[model samples]
Target: MRLWLESAVAGTPSWCLYNAVLSVLRATSALIISLLGVSMHGACVSAAGGRLNSRQRFLGSIVVAWALVPVPGRPQDLSRVEQLYEEAQSARTRGDFATAERLYIEVIRRAPELANAYHNLGIVYFMQRKYEGAAEVLEQAIRLDSKLGPAHAMLGLAYYELYRPEKAAKELQAALRLNPSDTNVLIYLGKAELQERDYKAAAKTFEKVAALKPRDPEILYDLSLAYMKLMLESIGRLGEAAPGSHQFWLLLAQDAEARGDEEAAIRNYQQALRVKPDVIGAHYGLGSAYAKIGKYDDAAQEFKKELQISPDDWLALWKLGELALRTDPDQARQYLARAVSLDPDFPQAVLAYGRALARAGKTEKAMEQFQRVVTLAPEEDSVHYHLAHAFRRLGREEEARKELTRFEELAKKKDERTQQMARRLIEMTRAAQPLADEPEPGFSPSRDPTHH
Candidate 1:
């Protein structure tokens, strides 16, 4: 029996059970259960056969001079155990949970080293709504084999149901470490973090789940709550130093916009303006948020407001010109030209000015600005498109064709790249699905313990 377990240990990774249970190595613990203890589920019993042999005595490299092995069970007993295990499973599957529980307990008593028995019994306890019982035995299974990721995950869920967030978090962490792709463990860990009021931790957990499940409304909702809580806490800390300052309201607006609360961002931006009528960037931020929701007219007005105080602000001029282009090409040319004059390197403003010139039938001047745009942003497909139109306006047919063909090629490549990114995101969600790490199947109780 001892030689059999030794051979089993030899066949398995040397540190498999040792590191799985204790997570460390030491001399004394290594001595008593080094081989059999490689698996905590293996037998630790010692006797004459378990004692050290002549080779070890001669080598003088042995501690307690004892070999360890799993307790030998008879073939008939092992056969009966398998039958009982199957019966328990069948009973549990059909909701005869009471009978299942009794049968599982008997199996465990006969084969205490069987981690599967403990794990299945834990499941039966869970089905019976006996959460405490489930936690207790699930932990035993983990103790027997810490590599049992499903046991850890199930234990975490049981702890969550019992309102033990700290324990739940710990077990979920263990499960995740063992199986990082387990979606259930991720969800439970996020919940445990939320219940503990560790919003930052919750956000981290939920964000990973969200990345894995981009369309999951519940994960998104929880993530938003965490973001809001953390932001509020930060705002509170800031408010402590400077209460009701214009900067406070401006910061609030920026935070709201970052969290995707456009309405709140607008409100905070407005409040900033009310607190200090000339608060810098308040109008610009409000305009940006308005633009996000397609309120172009409102956005234009806000940009105009920004220019009232900072008349030479090229960004405000450029934004005002871009917004005006849809409704007032003439107005767009005036602001855009001024914006380009103020900052020649502003590609967007230069492009808008070119477009405005084209709209006003100044094809020659439009060509100059479009050529400058090409120099500044040579790889921009839209620039090529606008330049092609400029060539057409000037009646340069061959040049127009060349530019249009390049535009189409760039656009196609851009579209393919975009589609590739979308496919990657979709594939990410599929890989997020949980996978169970099943044990290898060679070891069995029915295999002759004395065969070695």
Candidate 2:
């Protein structure tokens, strides 16, 4: 190749030089094949040349040959671009960012339309936490190759890091369209939906993720947070729509419930229903208050009403299952099973369903449910206690003992956390306002009333 360049300096035409180089390359390939005792057509540059096969040998030789010679006036020197890309990737793997950046930038300069080069350079910028720079390069990559899913993904992440959720969502949706089963794209889409306060959309998106990777606490937690925010936003919107209607009173009852005023909350919720019998959320709020006060029968009725109004309410189903657990295992099993089927990752509903399964003499099935509960909510003491009981019932003494020990440890930690939280609440209350002027009247004396 160097000799060909020397001849070029002696007034050889570029086309003639290119033909001479091609002839020399073919001669070298034929000589090497003969010397290595391998067929020139089916070679792999290995011992006896039985390794990488024809396609690999062909591509490998092309890469080597391209690195040794510069092809001018071509649309793209793909071999040179791929070789540089491989070198950049090697440098990136070793965390040599400077080398990677330089090589990738050079690849882009040589092949200005190389999407992979721009994509990798964007990743290098992202690794350095330069989100703005990543966005710029990744956008260019997307322009070069609209089907480049990874470029869209990186651009979405960059936009997210730059606090541009709408753009992030758009780019993530594009990426997800290209690569439908990507968990990272789904997670980031959920995050963008959440940041935009599209709670229902976020919950639905996270539900797909939860189904894909069950027992992932982070996904479950995000789903739960979305549900909670959706609930709060619903109430807030209801109040905004009807300032003095039954919905507004229902909001007040919810506030009362939040303040631990179960009896008053129940009364307020009842009044709300009386004001507007078909009011949304009133029945559920009343049911929750009744459940808080241990009025299981009353709670069950209210939940039944809510379920009639909204047939797919998993929370209503869960409450009904809880109300029937001690009295009717068959009925509890039906409700809890349906609740679990509706929202399979729901930890509390799963715990209740496990208890019902145990009552129905399905010991192994009960154990499975309890184990799922542990996976879903390892911090919950009730699941551990019930699981220990389930293990004992199955005569798994060692497993039972382990669960009991875990339960004890978790209970102690939970108690300490509760105490700390209580103290913090008291301090916050003291700092919020003076003692509420000795507490408002008509508050129930037994907020945590024991079941009769």
Candidate 3:
């Protein structure tokens, strides 16, 4: 049994587990049981097990270990054990883990079958960072009461700390099956999945957490990282299977666009179009990149080509409408009206339509569109800016002033948000860079227990 547990720990990558669990353990104490301790007899029993592939020997040892626990003979002794258990619970709550550990040992000695005592003991061992002890006790706890979800979760966390991701994932999954809404367990399981390189499963797990806490930056970051890993895997396979294909160029263009390399994006997107002119997104991507570089005529031509391929593309129509607003307001309105009708909930299209209406000398209609944009995106600075202009044109001075003030406030906040995002991007890039002292590829260093 000892050999099996050590092998399990040795099989996992320690660095991977360290990175996976460090971010998650911040809220671990709050998520786990309040009462906890480790059983002395269980620890002593699992201390030595050299027999490998001998289930009969392991089972016999377990039976002997169980037989060694002292069970009380009277009801009064049982009541005394309950009193001692309560004292251990108090000690654990007060952070006196030593006293709690001692009292819990006494409780287990009196009532050997009490799974909660073992479960609580596992929690104490976990808190003390004695993960081997924690795993042993938690396993016993689970064996005694298979339905104990907390025990399962605690055991999984211990396995994670011991660098046993496969076992950790299994136990964490079991815990989730018993309580699907346990977000902390879900987080641990997601990290374990990530360590295992199961990117799709990790993404799904993080998505569930995102659904529950939509604004959590850590959860969002994990989900994005998982998706980025999945994208890299897919891109690798695509490159191996279809080198220099139009799809490959299109993917590269989209990646360049996301990285804000508009010039590279335009080049790749054009290559995609040259390879397969009828590809769905190639023209639009090329046009967008062209627009970013101030080539409006080129952008307009590409947008028209995109429309030729997909006549009902609302995004293409919206781009054309935006490009025409500076030169031909009436033509802009024509294109934007169709775009807005196709996707009325889109704030950018509605805002552009309002701008075109204002330029066409239709102030009332423009004001209506601006109001609608505000409802669709109240926090959007440009929407408020356009609404302010509409109000000023209508001689509503006070309302225009209010809208301008709101626009200024939102613009400031938007600038701060952009700066924050830039900082986060830098941090993420730094995290992905190879370490200065990293070993060469294909090199394997001897395991260092002190690394944990």
Off by over 4 Å in 2: 1-83, 252-452
User: Candidate 1 has what TM-score?
Assistant: 0.58
TM-score of each: 0.58, 0.48, 0.63
lDDT of 1 at 335: 95
Q: How much is the lDDT of residue 405 in candidate 2?
A: 64
Can you tell me which runs of candidate 3 are displaced by over 4 Å? 1-117, 177-181, 326-346, 375-381, 394-413, 416-452
Q: What lDDT is obtained when candidate 3 is compared to the true structure?
A: 0.74
**lDDT (10s digit) by residue, model 1, range 150-220:** 78888987898899999999999998998897776798799999888899999999999999999999889
| Top TM-score model | 3
Q: 11-80, model 3: which lDDT tens digit per residue? A: 1113345435544543342232111111223322222433233554454445444444332322236457
Q: Which one wins by lDDT: 1 or 2?
A: 2
Local accuracy of candidate 2 as per-residue lDDT tens digits, 239-271 = 788866876777778768878999889888888
